[model samples]
Target: MVFQCQRDSWARQFATRVVSCRAAELRPEGGGEPVRGFQPDDRGLIGDVPVLRVTRRGPEAVHFVQAALEPGAEVLLSLDWERRFDHMQQHSGQHLITAIAEQMFGFKTTSWELGRQRSVIELDTPSMTAEQVEALERSVNEKIRERVPVMVRELAADDPEIETVRSRGLPDDHAGPVRVVDIEGIDSNMCCGTHVSNLSDLQVIKLLGTEKGKKNKINLVFLAGNRVLKSVEQSHSTEKALTSLLKNGPGEHVEAVKRLQSSVKLLQKNNLNLLRDIAVLIARDFKSKPVQSQLFVLHRKEGDSEFMNIIANEIGTETRRALVILEQDPSLCPQETLLFLTVGDEKEAGLFLLAGPVEAVENLGPRVAELLGGKGAGKRGRFQGKATKMSRRGEVQALLQEFVSHGSPEA
Candidate 1:
């Protein structure tokens, strides 16, 4: 058969604009040297990788090359093989998964998506639950344990054995032996993407999660082999910490965790009580102050959402117009990253200004954040995010003084 030029896909995929690179001599197979000087037909191919034809296709120079040995013929090699393995694994695994999903759940692997970072195999079954996905994962991995060789065979068009083929379909322009990959009695398909020679090559296939589609197209996300190994290592480390927290040996880990759960609930209630008392004391202090304008202050690391809300209400309660900047506190650490701020109308805009540094002033949001060693953005007179560290009481009181000393902030 004569060689035909297939359309190179490299052009469309990358919008690259590369400058010209000169070619040196084509070295024959035998010599180990760089061939010293340039040869006329000595294209970029011969030195390390020998050539058949050099075709300049768009940005990259695609070499129509063959191995230096017998049957040394044309094949494609590209430097950018980044993440192709994931696609191959997904497509290949789709076949195995589809085959097994049919047997176990009576559902077929009807469609697939070869994502750039992950792969998906859609199942025909509708309304798949989390439990079903877990079961599916277990069953597929069990099949892979069989270590059945994935045999790839090319047969003539007239081959009668084609009837016995587990092929899902035939390829285009069927002229030569049909390439069929068979996993013993399990699955068979006509595909172009490379696959592992045996099921065992897919040591561990983890189903990351799933999505829903029409007619119940259950799409699955998966990680294979090395990816699974990394995931497992992470899980093991977490469990090890959990065991230490439980204060029980691994055998009693479950009970220890339950005990911890009970303790956390008790702590939550006690914490709430403490915040209530703190709110009352702070509110009384505000009542004692002779008001010039409404005061709305934000303190980092000082407390939780409840405390912030309580203080905000206490400060604004007696104000004739009423306004405050009560920031929410974390149920745990008040200064922990959270959506913790309040905004009132411009009529009470002075209350907004009270956020001075802590929000003591309006336009100085960035400076307040900077003083706290943090980063953030704001517009429409409202802003919020995390600081590198929460402001202490003395630090917050100092900022309050600055706001009192200077009236309205500069825009």
Candidate 2:
């Protein structure tokens, strides 16, 4: 999960900036407890340049490992295969994407940050417009489909030609030939990160987002393989829903969807007119009733929040003594049920307790706020919620009924 950075201010000299301590390089190995069934050679690579296996905290991140270089660096490791897979996806993805970007845009990948969830590579040039990104994405996908071999070859650190390899990561030693990854005729870059067995194995490469940075550094973040598949499935499901809603035949799905979107604007206007008329009628009905004693509850199963507000205001303000309850979330109860209560200016205390087992109120309300939590108080028979305890709602209601009948001022 950790990598060497040339941009840091600590030391410009690569070797001076870095010291190799094998035990220190890998975080999992830093602790005192010995690993079970781990051989000495299982750390990262075949030699001194370390490759500590990443440990993922979520589906995407490697955590708890310190990435700085140390003298005689040892590696810490996690045994999770997903961590290794993430590295493989990102590293392999980098090779394909960067190579395509280079060929298409005349840009070089200057650096990259291998993050836990997604990786970002910096380009040497910036201002590549949106169209270029889209085209590059398509080309990378094509390259992956080609399923070209990804080979890792190690050379003596002393080889002169090692300087010719395009690499994101270069070790300080000129003493040995270098380690280079050759992607057939496409790319040859020096890197220590894990990679997929073949280009096809990397599957999909999705450019999630990107950011422009200083000195023309474009930070491109993307996902590969399974992540891309899941995203595509989710988008397809949404599209199908949209298509069905538009009432368009499958053959004309796109046209249907566009038509529906346009129709919805007009439909919304008509629906609003209907709702406003309904609100007026309800207001008139409540104003005509006995103001001192009216209880009205209105519910809309389709989750129209405005409808709830409309009915509540009509009944409560018109009758003055009306208690209008409106809810979209019916808990576990039937969708039609909503609760309301009303009382006159006599201030006869009444409680609308939805006190019951949580199961009873599961679909019942936001009323749990009042029933269990003792959340509210009022002058007349109008008290509401901080729903707390679920038990004894029925008993509490019965007791309050008696208090109201007896003309108690509060309950």
Evaluate all candidate structures by whole-model CA lDDT and list the values in order.
0.54, 0.54
Task: Tell me the TM-score of model 2.
Answer: 0.47
Error of 2 at 97 (Å): 2.2
Output candidate 2 Cα RMSD: 13.4
Best by TM-score: 1
In the range 146-215, model 2's lDDT, one tens digit per residue, is 8888887776666776677786555343333355777888988776556766888887898876788777
Q: Residue-wise lDDT of candidate 1 within 1-411, one digit each (tens)?
A: 111111221111222222233344445556654443221221223334544445433323444334331133332333333344444455567778777777778877666776655577777766677897799889889877877677666667688877875555753433445666677788776654456667787786888877777665777777776567767888789888977776666788888778878999999888779868977786677567654333344443335545655655554454322222222333322111111232222121211112212343345566556555555665433444445534332353455446555644333
Q: Which one wins on lDDT?
A: 2
Worst 10 residues of 1 by lDDT: 1-10
Misplaced by over 4 Å in model 1 are 1-92, 103-105, 113-120, 128-147, 154-179, 203-215, 220-238, 289-300, 321-407
